[model samples]
Target: MLQVQGVFKSYATPQGPLAVLQGVDLHLEHGSSLALMGESGSGKSTLLHLMAGLDQVDRGTISIAGQRLDQMNEARLANWRRTDIGLVFQQFNLISSLKIDDNLAFQARLAGRFDPLWQAQLIERLGLGDLLKRYPEQLSGGQQQRVAVGRALASKPGLLLADEPTGNLDEATSDEVLQLLLDLLRDSATSLLMVTHSTRVAERLAHKVVLQNGRVADAGER
Candidate 1:
């Protein structure tokens, strides 16, 4: 459902241009999950951002569900991102002012794809029903992240892009959250592309690809 070909990205430094990703190629099939592994400067997050259309790639093509992200104007990309991409960052990114219920429905409302039944199922499955009346600050880290996941999936996006989604939680909590995420993805048939540093996390996905020297060093099924 996603493809990246010969993608190159660089940023200007005081001395010169520093290339982060060079000629990177990768693909993820529909209803599959892929884990992206790399060291701190290996461009894992850059690749994820390109696929999400949050930033334009300096060169190469990124296509999601047959649409090329590099070719779209900002307006079109914004609209596409809202409807087709679900993003979960390391930080929960929940609205502090809004209660859990409002935060859960935020994205779905924006995308005009809100479904009460689907949301009800999400709340039940994520064990978030009891937290609906609480604000973000009032909940624990795991609870907040669960709310974040619920918000991201509320719209039923075709793809889910996660960046160190479990970074803040403890090992047990991380595993719990990851299992819940994988289960939800399976139910909706949504493709997943997650950037993580943990091998244990990587092993849980269907495929794993390691980045080295700005290129995909190897990719294989787990």
Candidate 2:
């Protein structure tokens, strides 16, 4: 459902242009999950950002569910992001003022894919049924991350892009969140491309791809 071919990206620095991703090629089939593993500055997050169309590539192509992301303008990319992708960040980017229920339903409402039944189910499944009236500041890190996952899935998006989804939680809590996320993905055709530093966490996915110095160094079943 997602494909990246020969993607090259770089950024400007004092010295010169610093390459972040060089000829990175990867693919994930429908409903399949893949872990993107790499050390700091290995370009894992850069690749994910390219896939999400948050940044432009210097060269090559990125296609998600047959849509040419490289060809889209800013407005079109924003629309695609809203309609076709569900993103989870390490910071649990929830609105400080919005209550849990509104935060969970925010993206779905914007994407015009809101379903009360599905939203309710997600809240219950993520163990947020009772916390719906609470604000982000009122919850723990794990609870906040659960709400983030719920918000992402609430849109019922075709593909999920997560950047260290469990980064801020404790190990045990991270495991819990990952399991709940996997269970939720199993119920739909949504594919996952998650960037993680933990090999153990990467092993939980069906496939793994290691990035080294902006290139895809290894890709194999996990």
Candidate 3:
């Protein structure tokens, strides 16, 4: 569903142009799960941003579901992101003012695909039934993360982009949340590209890729 070729990205810093990715190539089949493993400066998040079309690439080609991302202008890409991709951040970027239910349904509604039945199912599956009326600040870390996961899946996005989705939770909660996310993605036949620090989590996915020194270090049969 996604293809990338000869991707390169660099940024100008105080020192000089800092290269994060160089001639990177990747291919992901539809409805599959993949993990991105990398050290701090390896550009894992930067690659994700490029893959999701959130950031522009200095050079290379990216295509999602047969649509060439490199060809889309800003306005076109913005709409594609809303309709085709679901993003989950490490910070659980929820609005403090919106209720839990509202936050979970916000993106889905924006995409014109908010289903009440599916929303109720997500609330139950994420174990946020009672916390629906509560605000993001009122919920525990795990609860808030669950809400974030729910929000990402509400629109039935074709692709899910998650960055350290379990970073803030305890080990037990992290495992629980990770399993929940995998299960939901599998059920929906949704493709997932996630950045994770844990090997155990990486092992559970269908594919694992390690980025190092601005190139792919490890990507073999799982």
Candidate 4:
């Protein structure tokens, strides 16, 4: 469902251009999950951002479901992102002012794909039903992250892009959250591309790929 070919990304530095990703190539099939592993400066997040269309790649192509992200205009990209991609970040980016219910429903409503039955299932499956009345600030980190996952999946997007989704939790909580996420993804048949540093986390996915020197150096089924 996703493909990245010869993707190169760099940023302007005081010294010169700082290349983060060079000639990276990767792919994720439909209803499959792939974990992206790399060191701090190895460009894992950069490639994720390129796939999400949050930033344009300096060169090469990122295609999802046959549409080229690098070729789309900002307006089209924005629309595509809203409808096709679900993003979960390390920070658990939830709206503090909104209650859990509102936050969970926000993205689905925005994408015009809200389904009460599906959302009800998500709330139950994610263990979020009791937290609906609470605000983000009132929840623990794990709880908040669960809410974030619920929000991301509410629209039932084709792909889910997660960047260190369990980075803030303890080991037990992280495992709990990861298991919930995997179960939900399987239920929804959504393709997953997650960036993580933990081998344990990577091993849980269907496939794993390591980024070295800005390219996919190793990749295989777990």
Candidate 5:
């Protein structure tokens, strides 16, 4: 469902042109999950940003669900992100002013894909039914992340992108969140591309890709 070919990306730093990705080739099949592993500054997140159309690719092609992301204008990219992609960040980017219920339904409503039944189901499955009236600050780190996951899936997005999704949680909490995420994605048949440093977390996915020095060092399917 996602494809990248011969991708090269760089940033203009005061020192010089800092290249982060070089001739990177990656692919994810429909309804398949892939974990991206890399050390700091290895271009893993940069690749993700390119796929999300949040950053311009210096060279190469990125296609998602047969749509060419590199060619899309900003407006089209924004719409595609809202309609086709579900993103979960390490920071749990929730609206502080909105309550839990509003936060979970926010993106879905914006995408015009809101389904009350589906959202309610998500809330229950994520163990968030009782916290709907609470705000982000009122919940623990794990609870906030659960709400983030529910929010991401409420829209029934074709692809889900998670960046260090469990980074802020403890080991046990991280495992719990990861399992919950995988279970939901499997049932929903949404493709996943996650960036993580933990081998245990990466092993839970169907496929794995490791990046090094701005290139794909290794990739394999379990």
Candidate 6:
């Protein structure tokens, strides 16, 4: 469902360009899950951004579900992001003013692909049914994060790109929510590429990939 090859990205600093991802290669099949692990300065999140088309690659090709993102212009990329990619950030980028239901369906509505039935189901499954009318700030950190998660999956995009989805939740909440996410993704036939710091969480995924020094240190077999 996804393929990335020979990706090289860099950022400029006072000294010169600081390289983050170099000659990175990745492949993921349909409905499969991949866990990416690495240290603070590693290129895990950078790769995720590239895959989601949130950032441009200096040199590489990113193809998700047979659509090559590297060839898209800004407007096309935005459209692709809205229609094909679902992203979960560590910051849980939920709209502060929008209520739960609206937030969940925001992207879907924008893309003219809103599935009201699926949205309602996601709200209930994420335990946000009772808080549908409430804004994001009205909830606790965990609740907000779950809402963010619901928002991402609500769009029913083919590829799910998550960066530290459980980063802010408690251990128990993390496990519970992740299980829900996994079960939902499995049932919905969505592919996942997640970046995480915990091996315990990584092990739960079908494939584990380690990103070290801008390269693959170890990759688990399918």
- Could you give candidate 1's per-residue lDDT for residues 1-222 as a string of tens digits? 999999999999999999999999999999999999999999999889889898888889999999998779999999998999999998999999999999999999999999999999999999998899999999999999999999999999999999999999999999999999999999999999999999999999999999998999988896
Q: Give the TM-score (vs. native) of candidate 2.
A: 0.99
Model 3: lDDT of residue 203? 86
Candidate 5 Cα errors over 4 Å, as ranges: none
Q: For each candidate, give its TM-score against the true structure.
A: 0.99, 0.99, 0.97, 0.99, 0.99, 0.96
Please provide, for model 2 over 22-74, each residue's C-alpha lDDT reduced to its tens digit, 9 standing for 90 to 100.
89999999999999999999999889898999998889988998989977899
Q: Give the TM-score of candidate 5.
A: 0.99
Residue 27's lDDT in candidate 5 = 94
Looking at model 2, the pairs that clash are none
Q: What is the lDDT of residue 1 in candidate 6?
A: 94
lDDT of 4 at 90: 98
lDDT of 5 at 118: 90
Regions of model 3 farther than 4 Å from truth: none
> Least lDDT summed over 10 consecutive residues: which range in candidate 3?
213-222
Name the TM-score of candidate 3.
0.97
Off by over 4 Å in 1: none
Candidate 6 lDDT for residue 106: 90
Q: Model 1: clashing residue pairs?
A: none
Against the unseen true structure, what C-alpha lDDT does each candidate score?
0.95, 0.94, 0.90, 0.94, 0.94, 0.88
Give the residue spans of candidate 2 off by over 4 A: none
Clash count for candidate 5 is 0
